[model samples]
Every structure is written in structure tokens, then in C-alpha cells.
Target: MQDRSTFHDAATPLPEVAGYRVLRRIADGGMSTVYLARQESLGRDVAIKVMRPEALGDEVSRRRFENEARTIGRLDHPHIVGIHQIGRTADDRPFFVMPHMTRGHLGQRDLAGDEARIREILRALLSALAYAHARGVIHRDVKAENVLFDDADRPLLADFGIALRRGYGSRVTSAGLALGSTAYMAPEQARGEEVDHRADLYAMGVLTWEMLTGRLPFEAQDALSMAVMHAQDPIPRLPPHLRHWQKFIDRSMAKYPLKRHHDAADMLQALERIPYGPQRSFSPRDAAAAGVARMRDLPRGAWIVLGLILAAGLGFGLRHGDDTARGFFRASQPQPAADSMAVGGAAVIDNPDDALLRAAPESEASTLVEDARRQLEQRRLVSPSDDNAYDSLVAVARIAPDHLELPQLSAQLARALATDAVRATKNGDDADARARFERIATLVQATGLADDDLARELRRDTTAALAVRIDAAARRFDREAARKAAALAGVANLDADALGRLRRQAEAIPAVGAVLPGDPARMTVVRSGDGAYALTRRHISRSEYARFAEATGRPATLCRERASVLRVIARRDWTDPGFEQNNADPVVCVSWDDAQAFAQWLGARNGHRYRLPTTVEASGSAAAVGSRAVAEWLLDCEGDCVRRKVRGSSWRRDEDSRARDGGRGYDDVGFRLVREP
Candidate 1:
């Protein structure tokens, strides 16, 4: 058999498959090539997997390819990719069509440290596997590459080409080639022994480990070496922060198949029980061990210096009996008998410094405030436990509620957090940005700085950040992100009118894939008798018009320039416009015919219908349209249909609503588009 990598390249022209217009080849595997094509009857995108011509000579490859379509065709589940139809190309090569997953596959996503997203994907895959297992079909290859995501970002298990159904013969594959990925293969599967659904569960375990830690549990130089490692290597431990998931990992990737979860459903249950957040609690012994480990890693010179400091401090406490020394020694002591202290009905591990601060607020307040300032300087805002700025500031507030410097320090910290939020947003880490903003809000309340400058600065920064986030999300057509940003805006106390505008922008993203084509950042969602549609808040700009014109090779028509009366200037078109205007200015001098062409081009490109708004739709938006300095073309025509209706007042003359010849261009005439929902 030929190696899987030795198949046809996408550069080669694809053979026409009946009933589908093949756009391009998306993926190529050992046995087939997947094409992104439009299904003729349904007018929707679908993925068509066609077998390679070379694979036809091999009966085993042929049977496996046919088996994939038949097996998937028999199973019906939302999380599993279903076969729309099975057919053969002109040359008799078998092929199957599936939903076009535009979001790509699991392997392409940056899932590291995104626990919620990882869990969501895992749940979908497990549900799919459970459905398949009940029918006695095991997905032999359950790696990340086989999981695809649809446009809505829902994950679906695909490529059941190498699946093994119960009662199928024990031959895993042809001669020496392994049918599964070595990195995720169970010991039994790696050893060429009989396997069951537990084998699939083991691969799921490997997948879970990879998703959680961003790396595989075991690694080797080659496939055979990796297989050996999977069969014999001890299961690796998760990072200390993710230790809570170790039990799930151990059971899922057990060296022996029998030791793994009994079925996919059982494994999914185990997964659900695992907490999404960190749940590890440290005992005194664990803390001591950690301290010792840190000490061992320290240089000998540092250890001696630490011993001298402790010895000197002890002598000072004994000789002078100073309360500061006493407090220091008290903090150095081990944790109390009770591992955790109850606060506000929640069990939290006691912080020795916090306890000391509460016990002697008068003397410790200044020191705690200084420590907080230092932590803030280091950018250690809310992490590393007893050492972060947040805990230090909170301790100061509790111990000395009336401390003179408390308000200033709290405001500074809030400002720093807001800055971090903006930085995170710029870096495309929206989750971290939101967390920072939430922390700032909580900090203001927790430290009693709500009425101070902290609150004002927070509202200001949040308003600006919300504007950036909402506009960006709308441009990307990410409705969820926009909605979340709107919620954040509400939390920041944005005024009713401004908040409503932002909310409307967020709601319009999915309706049109983005804001209006020309405005770049502003669009209005309008509801009329025809239905809901998105309209550009402004007339199409010069820069936006240039793109359409350049792409379609559209020529500019003569415009009626206003200089010593109106005359059609041969050289004056939208590009020149007979006036000095920037790219941001509304494009003018385009005839009604040109506007229709631009609309058609945009609709075809975005997979959404676009056109000039009807007279009623334009009338409804009369306030916005009349404010602009250009008259816009409307879809309605007058009299013998020789003239198109125009709305809005222009810079030159006031023509609120009138009809003009469709073939001629005017210096003050341009257009806006309505995107159908």
C-alpha cells in the first residue's frame, strides 16, 4: 500500500463530482481528499471527500473508504458529522458529502489554558462517542485532528475511516502499518492485540491531557518509539496547578485497557465531577514540603544569609521584646491546628501575615501598605497567594479601615488593573481583559473606594474599552463577544442612551456578518414591514467605494460639477469628485446603476444579500439620512421608471426627496446599503 502522504496534491485539478460545484480542496489524507463545494439543490456549502485514484487498486483501502461512508450514514447524531449523500466521481472513485465546517478542526485552535472551551469540546466529543459506541462502532482514531468545528464553533467528531465495529476480524491494518496515531493509541491497540471501546476512551484521555496542558503526555522520536512509550511509559503527572485533574487522566489513559473507564458515558460522568477551577488545598505538611523544596533549590550562600537573619531576629525578640519582632516570629510559625479558617461562611486557608495584620493593625498597617505598593510595582496584582497586591491591600483595609493612605493606594491599584485590561484587549486576550476589569470593580467595592477616583477612572476606561471591543466584535461577526462587551458596559455604568446604542450594534453583527460595508464602525439595525436589516449609519465612503471599483474594474461616469452653475464635467467622477475630500468622506458622483452594481458585488462576497433600501426603509431612517451631506439613491423608481428616487439633503442643494435620471451621475449623490437579515 502507498503511504498516506503520497496522494494527490491540491495543486492538481480536481475531477468534477456530480451535483456539487467544487470550490477547492481543503484537506488530503492517506485515502481521500476533502473539497469545499456548494450543494446544488440546497444552495449550501458542503464538504465532499473523494477517494484518491491510486487507492482504487488496493482492495483493503477501497473497503475501508466505503465502510466509512456506510458506517457514518447509519449513525445519526448532532455531534457526529453526518453523510448527506454518497456518490462516485466521473472516474468511479467513491465520495461522501458532509456539512462544511468553516471553523476548521480542533488541532488548529489555541486551547491551552482555556479550560471552559476545552471542556465544551470534550463534552461534545464524548457525547458523539457514546452514540457511536452504543452501535458497536469504535472510532479507532480519536485524535484532535479528527474533530471538526462548524461555523457556530460547535465541535463534531469526523473521519470514521479507520473505525472498527464489533465482531470485525482482528487484522488492524495491512501488513506493518498501524491504523491509529501512535501518540494516542492504547497499549492493547499499540501491541496489535484485540481492543474494545476502552481503547477509544484511552485516546480520549490522551486528548484531554493534551488540551489541558497544551502538550502530549508521552513523546518519542518516532512512531514505533511513541507506541512503545504509550504501552510501557508511566502516566505523566499534570502541572501542580492542574493536579485536580490527575485522577481523570490516570483512569482515562490507563496502561491496561480494563483499568480505564468502562464506557464513554462513564468517562463523561467522571469529567463532569472534575471542578472547572483550582480545587487543591494545601496541608501544613504539604506547605512544609514545598518550603523544603524551595530551600533545596536555593544557593548555599542564600541559605546561610537566611539563617543569619532568622538568628538575629530571634535575638532581637528575646532581648528587646519588641511587638514587631514578636509579630514576625508569630508569622514564621506553622499554620494553626485547623487547616482553614471560616470567613463569611466559606472555608479559606489562613494566611499567617493576614492573621498578624488583623491581630496588630496599628503597627502593621504601614508595612502592609508598603508591601502592596511593591507588589503593584512588580505587576503581581492578584496571584502568588500571600505576596500579591490584592491580598496585601485587602489585608490593610480589614486591619486598618481608617488608614490615611488606604484610599490613595486602592485608587492606584484600580488604575493599574484598568491599564492591564486595556493591554490584554490589545493582545487579543479578551478573557483576561474581562477578568481584569471585573477585578477592578470588585477591588473598588472591597476596599471602600467606590466613591473615590477609582470608580470614575474605571468607568472612563471601561467606556473606551467597550467601544473598541464592540466595534471589533461586530467587524468579526462575533455576536457572543459583542454581547459580553455590552454587558461589561452596563456594569461600568454607561448611560442609558449610549448603552442602548452599543447593545444595538452588538445585536446587528450576526444579522449582517458585520457592520455596514462602507462605514467600517457604525451600523443601525432597522425593523420595517419587509423585515429586519442592517443599514450603514453613513453614506459609503471614498475608500470603501474604491475597493468595489478596483475589484470589478468599474469605470467612473461624468459628474455635474458646481462651478459658475452646474455643468457635466468629463474628468470629474467619484475618484476626483471635483472637490478635495479625504477617504473618510462620503463618495459622490456615482449613478444609481453604479450603486446597484456595488451592492450586488458586496452581497456575493459576504454570502448575504445587499441592495439599496426601499423608499419606506429610507423614509424611516430619514433623520439619519437628512443629516448626511450627500443624497442617497433608493430602490424606488418614479413615472416611467427612467428616474430613481433619491433621499436626504446634499452639501450643494436641499433635495429631501426627488427623482433623478438613473443613467446620469450627480456631484452630491451617493448610496448606503441594506443588509438583509
Candidate 2:
């Protein structure tokens, strides 16, 4: 895997090819030496993959190397690198030319942390796979190293040197020709059994899992051991956050070919069903194109009707604004002649509430409904699987429930979103799923409670999610988390037994009372020791520091580099501790001088003793075994006042974490002041 580009000068001779000039070597793969060269005839740069000198002697590998050109030439896809031409050297050494991808391979870049981008990447991947599969080409080697990209990070499949095509003669010199990268190969392929497109699908599943979680399902030190592992090992269960894809992965990577999706198209459909992430922006043109594709699948007259609807919608959209025009277009639909009861040759609007829509389709509220419909359609087509923003859709449904198809669509959306919420809950996205369910209830309400059953079910679903979380939190003895979950379940008005059961075993808390300073920081009595003097519950917060700064007119230096990207300048007061620390969190970046100043200010105002804790008081008196409560400042050393002993442990601990010496000085360090009252 050495991508060494050797320059040819006096000592090194420049390599030559048939129709191209080799500028330098780009990479060295297992069977080939890839070169960055300019195709003189085409006047463009290309990557020439030359069969390694050793590989040329092996007739089997040589034939297989030539087969790559034909395999890729037959399977032309945008996401797959295009073959320019095929040629052989004077010695009959095979080589092929392809566009030089500057961005290199997936192995050179990391994508495991980007879930949203990975899902989007998979969309393009499906398009490419479906195209290749239709042409009978199975990309046997689909590891990260074989996937190259352009400057924009759009992936292109490469190295079809070992591809297996159904109708074509494979480069299989023997019945036991070994193929593919070991770590990513399917079980059947690994075992050297007769493989099909399912092997390709298995590799795709393995690649997808690696992209998301950064590890192969089965791995071993040697090829033989790895092959055996793939054949016999049970599919590893995904983490809760990824369990939503369990069935999909299981089906795709099923050991038996018959058990997997029969074709690439079916696997693509399965991928399309997953609610990937946040809503992505899709142009109106894109929506229209998708709409046309969908309409093509419908009856002939449906396209004509669609054209008429778009015409009317555009006219209305322009005249009254996006909402009204959209509303006016749908509301203008001719009422079923027989369904509507006629009153003096005029149709009575169905449902009295929709009379406003029937009265004036040009009304702002009706327009809003129309716009809502357009938004809904775009959302459905653009992100068919994701449960995105529904505020606008719900708002318009309330105005024209009868005239527009809003009521019907709302009900369907309610059911779909509820199902998605349950799926999300199972995937451990409880907060997001709970929010989506709440939105579903709101949408149902906008439809004038048309489906009360759906509303009830949504409420039940939300309650159930909370119950699951509450039980889980309780099991982990996370009382704070359990309390929050139970509070959420209480919103649905759960009966005493169900909700009360979670709160029955109230967590024992120390009887520590708070003493509010004349300033801002609150002091709490140390329950583990005598209740004479209380240690500050937390270190001096930024708010307390701000107050100290404002009153004493002393400068509290604001931290320059803030961790919260979207935070305002006011919040960036110290070094970002890598994660979110709330207003309740102790303030960092304060020097010992700053800590003493605040303590002195509070003491002078309240006429009570306020000071840093003694070393024994911090180590013995404090209940410091929680996740990451801030480390506190201890009194200065016995003789040397310059160095102060810092006590307590944090989420990030060091070797000298408990060595209560005045040695560890830090910019983000915080301190606690104990009151001497």
C-alpha cells in the first residue's frame, strides 16, 4: 500500500507506456503499480495500472488482470471509475487507464464519525451498485482501499481486477480461484465456494458497518483463520444506537445466498427505508424530477393531470403567495358531483369547518394550507424515510381540513411518524423520538381530532418510550435520569401505580441544606462530616464571576477558544472541557488570586467566613465519587503560599489525581471555597 511517486532524473529512467507518458508512480497495490501519466492522444492525465512484473509471469493472474478492463467497460456507472482503454506492453504485460482521482481512497480519509454523510454516501452507492448489478458485474473486492473519490469526496468504485460477471467468462483458472480482500470477503467467497451477487451484498454490508462503527464484524490474524471465522461466526449484535439496522445487516450479510436480498435493487430499497438523519435540502427541480419518475409509474392520464395541477398551482402560488396558491389549487378541485349535496344548483361544502376554504380559496389561511401541501409533498419525496419538521404541515391542516387532502395525509403521516418514533426509541434516540411523537399528536390535533384513535395511540407511544427509559435508568441506579424520564411519562397523565412505581424507591440523598451567599455561589453543608461549615456545592460559576467582576471592577479574562461552536461570546469564559458543562458547572480558567478575591468579597458582604477548603476537608469530607464533579482548590501548602494543593477527581484523571499536592497547576482548573461561619 505504498503510494510512492518516484521521480525520474539522471539515475532513474522514466517509465514508458504505449499511448501515455508516465510522470511518476502514484501507488503500489498487491498486483499492480499504478502511475500518474498523461494520455498523449487524449491530452488528459490518467492513472495507468500496470500489472506488477511478478504478476505477469502468473498466467492465471495475467488473464484475470486483463479481465478487469472488460468487466468495468461493460458496467458503466457514474460512481464507478470509467475505463479509457486497455493495452499491453511489448512483453505482453497488461495495463488499463482510468481517470486520476486526486482525493485518493477511503482508507486515506476517515468517515466513521460522520453518520449523516455516510447515509448520503450510501444513496450514491446504491445507484452505482444497482447499475453494475443490472449489467451482471459483481464487484468482488469492495473494501475501503478500493473505493476512490474525487475532490468533492464523491466515491467511485475501483479495482474490478477480480470482478465476477454472470454471463461473461470469469478469470477463474481453476474451480478454487481465491478472490477478494480477506477482512471484507463474504463467507461463501471466503470459503472459495461458488459465489453470486449475494457475496457482493455481504461485502457491502461489511463496508457499511465499518464506515459507521470502524470495525469489521469478523477479523483474524491470518487469511485461513479469517475465512473460517466468517463461515462459522454468528453476526455480532450492533450497539443500541445502531440496532435499528440489525435486520437489514442480518439479511444482507446472511451466510446463505437464498436468505439475502435476491438483487441489488431490493437491497437499495431496504436502505431507502432507513430514516438516516436530519432533513437535507432538495431543490424544487429535484422534487419535480422525482415527481415525474413517480408519475411515470402511474397511469397515462395521471401525467396529464399532474401537469394541469402544476399549472394551476404555479398560477395560484404566484398570485396569492406560496401558501394560498397551493391551497387554492387543491381546493379548486371539482367536488364529486354525486357525493356533494346540491343546494340550488350550488354544491354545499362538505364539513362546516371547511366553509372558509370553500368561501374563498384565495384566503391567507387557505393559501397557507396550499403551501403546506406543497411542503408535505416535497418532504415525502425528498426524505421519504425521515421524520423531519412538521410544524408548517400541521399549521395548514388546521385551516382547511376538508378542501385540501391535508386531513388524509395528516393521518397517514401520523401513523408513519409514530412507527418511526418507535423505531427511534428502540435505537436509543429517545429524546428525538419522543419529540417526533409529540409532533404527531399536534398534527392529528390540527386535523380537528379526525383520528382520535391515532392521537390516543401517539400518547400511549410517548408514555411507553418514557417507561422504557425510566426502567433502564432505574436499573443503572441513575436516579437523576430516572426522575427526568418519570416526569416525561407524567405528562401523559399516567395512573398512580404505573408512574408511582418508578418513584417508589426514592433515592437516599444527604440532608445537605444550601446557604445562599450575598453574591451568587451557593454553599452546601458537608453531610459526611460535621454540619458546622458547608463547602460550596460547586465551584464559583461564570455568573458569580461576572457579578464579582461587575462589583469589584476586576477583570475576569474571557477564554478565547470556546468549545461550543454556536455559543455566544458571553459563554466562552474558559477552556472548553471537551463536553457540555452547564451553568451549574464550576467555572474554570480562574487563577488562585481570582478564587480568593471572590471568597473575600462574599465574606465582607455577609459577615461570615468564606475560604478555600483545607486538604483534609476536601479529601475526607466531600462525596467526590460522581462522574465529573469539578476538582476543588485546597488551602496553600504549610509554608509556601505560591503553590496550592488541588483536591478531588474528574472524568479525566491522571496518575497524581489523589496526590493532594499544590503541584498540578492548570488554566481550566476550578476551586471550591468553604465557609467558616
Candidate 3:
């Protein structure tokens, strides 16, 4: 096989497949070339995996290719890539279509140290494996390169070219070639031994290690050596920081299959037990160091008391001339009459511990304040360690208790967090934004900074941003965005009246493109030269017309096959126009009379007068809605009422407006309605 890296350097001719237009080659694997193509019938992008012509020459390769298509075609798991269609190209090369995973593969992503993301991918993959194993299928080629992601960044197990059914013999691998990638190959698999689902579990363990440490556990110069190492070498240990997963890795990569996890379900349970947060394991040396550090932090009062006891034990005589010793032990001893020492023209207090305590804390508080300010400048508000600004502030409060700078520092950190929260919100990361907001609230209450009004201002700004998101989503009919915005609003504690209005707007979004009588099509109010009226946002769709036809029992109209010629076809109507269309596509091939009939039927059912938009209304609405693929019928007619006016451009003609026969339907003509005020 040629190097996969050079596959794109050569300009390979695109293969012709029926009902699909191959746009470009996306990927080249050992046995197939995947192309991005548009499925014309569905009008959506799909990936077509065509067997390499050279592979088709080999009977075993041909069988494996066909087997992969048949294997995935029967499986219906969400995490598994599904086969859409299987067919042959113009040159008889076999091809199978699957969803175009636009986000690439797991190998292209960086999952290092992201336990939550890694766990998500692992759970999805394990569930897929479980499903496949129960159905007697084993994905022998489970690797990062085989795991693809969809548009939503969800991991999907793909590439089942070498998948084997439980009962099937190993004919596909009879050529003595190593099947899976050597880096992730199971020990048993590397030894050319008969393997089952447990082999995939071992491979999963290798993948887990790679994701956690950003490197493969075992490395060798060649595939042969790599395979040998998998069979004979001791299981590699995780790094010290990741030692919490040592038990999991040990069992999963056990030398024998029996010592490994019994099944995917059992592995899932083990994964659940693994903690996401870093675990701390202390050694005797570390404990001793901590003890020493604590002892060094003892106050001067404690040391003074120890010194006085020692002096009494030594039978030292007390004298007023011994000013140095007296000053040091003054707080612990009784007050000396008028002989108290005076320094720099100020009388020294008999109890020196009060001054010592205040001096020590003031020095410590100054250092803490400096550290906190530096951390704040570095944006280390709450993470990386106990050395962050938040922790420093807290330490100052504990030591000084009434440090003058504490409130100001707390307020600065709070403002910084508020900035982060707003940034997260703008980036559409509602969960991260919510977490930051909660942290800010905790800081305010902890420091008694509620009187600062920072929290209240942040709440108002965040709520306003979320409200904008809600309205924008409602306008675009994006239910997911609207739901996320609404959820964030709840977290922001938005006022009830405002929240209720936004909720109602989101609830009004249409579930489907079909506009029933009770649920009218989306419209925009247009103020034209004649009057103000509401015009439909888009041209009438086939699904909407289908509803109207079903309810009114209307017959299909004869539609012209082409716009230039009068070649009227009896079978061609809105349902069977020359091209394919989904429900959302504008309904073409409807005559002016047919459109009028539909408007009348809808108006009567909804108790509102509806008619085709006049030329003036459509011209005004076009600036707002933009031109569509089809020309739309208008209420105005030509001389003697023989032709009706059409506005906007059509698929065949890019002209703005034209007059067409009112009784005949053109394939590129549709209509939109105007609702009377």
C-alpha cells in the first residue's frame, strides 16, 4: 500500500456514483478512499468509502470490504458509525456511504489530562463495544485513528473493515499480516492467537493510557518488535501523577485475558470508581516535613514561655540591669515596678508579647498581600494550587484577621471573576459561566463584600446577555440555543416577568417546517407603499402544501417540465418536481390558481384572510427575507388577466420579476401568502 500521507498529493479522478455527486477525497486508508459527497436525494453531505481498485483485485480484501458494509449495516448503536447505502461505482469498485463526520477523528484531537472528556469518549466507546459484542461482532481494529467524531464532537467508533463475527473463521487475516495497529494491539492478538471481545478491552486500556499521558505506553523501532513487546514485556506503569489509575491499568493490561475486566459493563463500573480529581497519597517523609513547617510557625509567646521555664530551672538571678533578657521575657514574667526599660525616649510596656504578636502578624500580612496582588496580576484567581489570589487573601484574613487591604483585595478578585464569567457567557459556555458566577457569589459572602454592588451589577449584565441570546435563538428557530440561554437565565436569577416573556417567545418556535392551519407559517410584518401587512418569511414549502392538499382534497396540477417550453407533464406536480426536495424545500410547480386555492383553504380554516402577496409587498419583504430558489406568484395580473406577476428569482432565471400564465404551473415557481391586518 502507498503511504497514506501522500494520498492527497496525487490528483485522483473522482468516481461516478449514482444519486451522489463526489465533491472531494477526504481520507485514504489501507483499503479504501473516503470521499465527501452530496447525496442528491436527501440533499445532505455524506462520506463515501470506496474500495481501493488494487484491493478489489484481491479476493480476501474484497470479502473484508463487503463484510464491513454488511457488518455495520446490521448494527444500530448510536456510538457506532452506521452504513447508509452500499453500491458500486461506474468502474465496478464497491462503495458504502456513511454520515460525514465533519469534526475528524480522535487522533486529531488533544485529550491529554482532560479526565472528563476522556471518560466521556471511553464510556461511549465501551457502550458501542458492548452492543457489538452482544450481537456476535468484534471490532478488531479499535484505535484512535478509527474513532471518528461527529459535528457535535461526539466520539463514534468507525472503520469495521476487519470486524469478525464470533462464528466466522479468521480467513480475513489468513495472509499472516498483523491486523490492528501495533501500538494498541492486545498481547493475545499480537501472538496470532484466537481472540474475542477481551482483546478490544486490552486495546482500550492502551488508548486510555495514551489519552491520559499523551503518549503510547510501549514504543519500538518496528512493528515486529512492537508486537513482541506487547506479548512479553511487563505492563507499563502510569506516571506518578496518574498513579491513582494504576490498579485499573494493571488489571486491564494483565498478561492473561482472565485477569482483565470480564466485559465492557464490568469495565464501565471500574471506570465509574476512578476519581476525576487528583488523589493525594502521602509518604512518611512528606508528613515529617509538614510537621517541621508547622512547628516553625509557632508564635513568639510560646517561645518566651519556654525560655522562662528554662531560666527558672537554671536558677538565674533576676536583675534590673539585665535589660536585654528582661525585655525578651517581659510578657511571661510579672511586671517590674519603675525599672521598666525605655528605648528611643518611649517607655517600653512590661508585657512585650502584645507588641511582638502585632509586629509578627503585620509582617506576615504584608507578604501575603504582596503575594495576593502578584497572583491577581497573573490571573491565578482560584486555580493551579493553594498559591492563588483567593487562597492568599484567605490566609491573610486568618493571620491578621483585620488587615486593612483585605476588603480591597477581595473586591479585585471578585471583579476579575466577574470578567471571566461574562467572557464564558459570550463564548456560549453556559456551564463554565455559571460556575464562575457561583464562585464570585461565594467570595462576596465570605468577605462581607456584598455592599460593594459588584455582584448585583454582574448579575444584571449576565442576565441581559442571556436574554439577548434567547431572543436571537427564537428568531433563528434554534431550540438548542434557546434552551441553553434559558437555563443560564435561571442560574443568573433573572426576574420572573422578563423570564416569562422570553420563555413564551422560545415556546412559540415551530417544531417542523409544515405549517398547519392552527400553527401558521412564520411571518414578518412589511410596511409597503400601499399598506402594512404580514408576509410569510419564506416561500410555501412542500410539506405545508401537502397539509393543505390533504385537508382540502385538492388535486395535483399539471406542471411544465421546463420554463422556456410549454411541455406540460401530467405526472409532474409539487410532489414530483424534476428535482428532489425535503419538507423544508420551497414547493414549486404550483400555478397561480392553485396557490390562490391553497390560500383560501387556509384562510377559511384559520379564520384569517390569506392571499398571494402583491408585487409591492413581495418586493418590500424580499429585502428582509432575501431571494429564494424559486420565483413566487403575486396578486397582480397582466393585461386581460392572462398572466400573473411573479417576483424574486427562480432556479432557471435570475431575473427579479416576470409574468407567467396564471392557469399553468412552472417547475421553478412557488408562492408566499400575505395575511390581512
lDDT of 2: 0.65
Give TM-scores for every candidate, taking all chains together and pairing residue i with residue i.
Answer: 0.43, 0.42, 0.45
Q: Candidate 3: minimum summed lDDT over ten consecutive residues — where?
A: 1-10
Off by over 4 Å in 2: 1-14, 41-43, 90-92, 169-174, 277-677
List candidate 1 stretches off by more than 4 Å: 1-11, 172-177, 287-677
How does residue 322 of candidate 2 score in lDDT? 61
Candidate 1 at 610: error in angstroms?
Answer: 36
Q: Model 1, residue 662: what's the lDDT?
A: 84
Model 2, range 1-677, lDDT digits (tens) per residue? 22434443447444567767888777777677788898775577888888888887787777777777777766555688777657775556778778888887776666766876776667667667777878877788887787788767788888887787776654363247667877888888877777777788888888888887778888788988888877788888877677756777898878888988887766765664554332245799999999988867998787789889999988886877965556656665555657569899887767553455655436755665555566555655114334332654555655555656566656666677777776666456757666665766566566664764555555545545555565454333345655666555554444566567545532321134534434345666554432234677666775666666665666654432224454453434343534566555566656666778778767544435578888766654554323455566667554456666666655445423332334323434677887653
* Per-residue error (Å), model 2, residue 677: 85
Instruction: Give candidate 2's total backbone clashes.
Output: 5
Q: State the C-alpha lDDT per candidate.
A: 0.77, 0.65, 0.77
Model 3 misplacement above 4 A? 1-11, 282-677
Write the residue-wise lDDT of candidate 3 on 317-336 in tens digits: 45444765766665554556
